[model samples]
Target: MTQHVNEFIQQGLRVLDIERAGIDDITPSINQDFAQACELMLNCRGRVVVTGMGKSGHIGNKIAATLASTGTPAFFMHPGEASHGDLGMITATDVVLAMSNSGETSEVISIVPVIKRLGVTLISMTGNPQSTLARAADVHINVAVQTEACPLGLAPTASTTAALVMGDALAVALLHARGFTADDFALSHPGGSLGRRLLLRVSDIMHEGERLPKVRHDAIIKDALLEISRKGLGMTAVVDDNDVLLGIFTDGDLRRILDQQVDVHTTSIASVMTARCITAKPEMLAAEALKLMEDKKINGLVVVNKQQCPVGAFNMHDLLRAGVI
Candidate 1:
């Protein structure tokens, strides 16, 4: 049993080594042809239609999704469906990106004539440069691998990896050319956690109004502790009569005071609070606020307005509950 387990591990490692080498071999293929392919897609007035068959189709689907999320309008179309009637999805203004290991997929090649007739820009990623698909394309990206990870060399292992990496290379290159920003990506992925982190503001999840934890600077530590407990924010903002931020008191401060044997009822919060503390604007991004808390080694922040008045308060637990952490 031990020998069998060791053999299994060795086989997995060997497969990984071959795939890595295949990826390395394709690095040189990122040449003029790759740049031209990106240029065609970047300048495209319509979407990029990606099509492939079998294993290549799966990779094509992922490539299309990546392109769309990164600011390039793209979608996957199966080659088999294209011949049956889905070809209408392609427009003259659109660019057709076809993937095939051998560059001779019959379904893919069968549509080459129609693609050319429509005057659509054709970009082909294939292992065989001399194959029909490559010869018909305006731009051809070579994704040929020396060998497959499969011992039989019949499966589309290393070849598919090379093609997928090339597709990612194209998408990222176009993303840079278009100056796609993180904000733009967030817009496309609004339903995901990434979008929540980018789009949520400090005011969105902060405890405001009566829920805000705050106390007057003249208030004793005991009073601030009560406010903190009532608000359940683990901290309380120290403010002046005008509601202007003065300082902050937290559980950590309470610990220090207890060790010093200070009288919570007589000691004013201002005297024991953090005078020069980190604060966040209500309009600031939640992700930015989270980073500030992490960098300053604090667990909470007081959200203030332009006048530096405490308007809201939140802690690490708030961010976690809001899925911003």
Candidate 2:
């Protein structure tokens, strides 16, 4: 039993090694048809319809999502469903991207005839160049691998990896050709953390109006401390008579003041507050503010306007709440 387990582990490692090698081998091929694939997808007016069967179907679904999120409009359709009225989803303006390892998946191949009959552009990703799907396609991208990662050469391992990588290559190439920006990506993934970091601004997360931790510059340090305590932001913004920002006093400043035995009751916040404080505009990205805080080794910031007036305040806690951390 011990020897059998050892053999199994060895075979597993061998499979992984072969799969990695197969990925390396396909790099050159990716460069070959990459430009042509991008041109076809970029010029496509309608959605990219991805179809496959079995393990290939799983890879096809992921590829479709990657394409859709990266500026290409795409969706996956199970070829089995195409036989039962899903064929209506395809149109003359749409482009069809079909995936199969052998290039002869009957379920996928069956749809090829109908797709071609409709005069839709057909792009096939397969290992065998002479296979039916490849011959029928308007563009055939070869994603061939040396061998399957399975020990008995039965499982879909390296082949699927190659197909998936090829799909990603196509999507990213199209993304670059289309000049897709981070804002565009955020729009597609608005609910995810990446979207929150990119789309959310300081104004969206900062405490505004009555929630702003602020005090007049003429106010005593003790009064400012009370405002900080009330707002629970560990700091308070010091503003001028016209409500323009002057400086800020934080918990760190309080510690420094206590070290010098400064009188909180008699000392004005303007006297002890740190001027030239780092601040962010309300229109700036919250992610940029988060970086500033991390780089400065601080936990909080005051949001200001073009006139350097305190409009809002935020801290690491706010970033956590807003999902920008």
Candidate 3:
């Protein structure tokens, strides 16, 4: 049993090695054809129509999604369905990206003439350059693999990976061509951690108005402690009459002052507070603020305006809840 298990592991490794070699072989093919494919999709006035069948269909779906999220407008269509009503999804303004390892996937080959009739530019990805699909396309990108990871040399493993990589190459190239920014990516992906990191601002999560833990500079240490406890932020801002931030007194400061036996009821907050506190701007990205907090070795920050007035406050817990952590 142990010997059998060892063989299984070795077989998996061998498969990986073969697939890696296949990918390496395709690296040089990121050539003129690849460039033309990108340019065609970039200039496409309509959505990219990606189509294939079987394993190729699965890879096509992923390519379509990556293209859509990165900047290109694209969606996958089953070549089998294209013969039915789904062909209507493709317009003369669109571009068709067809994939087939053999360059003879019957479903994909069957749609070739119809795609041509619609006046849609066809870009084909295939391993066999001389195959029908390759010959029919306006531009042919060769994703040929020297070998399959499958011991029988039949599974789609290496070829699918090469095709997937080719799709990513095209999407990223188009992304660069269109000047697609991370902000634009965030707009497309508003629910994930990427969106939280890119789209959320300090002002969106910080405690504002009456919720701000604040005490007058002239107020006693006891007043600041009351504000901190009431606000539950572990710190209180020592501010002037205009609410401009003067200093901050956190629990860390309170702990240090405990060793000095300071009188909480009598000592003015201004005397005990940190005069120069690290602060964040309301417009600052929350993820950038998290990095700032990590670099400064602090857990909380006061959100200030252009004039340095305290507008809001936040802590590590807020970042965790907002998924910025």
| RMSD after CA superposition, every candidate | 1.6, 2.1, 1.6
Q: What clash pairs does model 3 have?
A: none
Model 3 regions lying over 4 Å from their true place = 192-194
Superposition-based RMSD of candidate 1 using all C-alpha atoms, in angstroms: 1.6
Tens-place lDDT per residue, model 2, 44-127, is 999999999999999999999999999999999999999999999998999999999899999998888889889999998998
Candidate 1's TM-score: 0.95
TM agreement with the true structure for every prediction? 0.95, 0.93, 0.95
Q: Model 1 segments beyond 4 Å from truth?
A: none
lDDT-wise, the better of 2 and 3 is 3
**Could you give me the TM-score of model 3 versus the true structure?**
0.95
On residues 193-293, what C-alpha lDDT tens digit does candidate 1 reach at each position? 78899888999989999999999999998899999889998899998899899989999989998999999989898999999788999989999999999
lDDT of 1 at 114: 97
Q: Which is the winner by lDDT between candidate 1 and candidate 2? A: 1
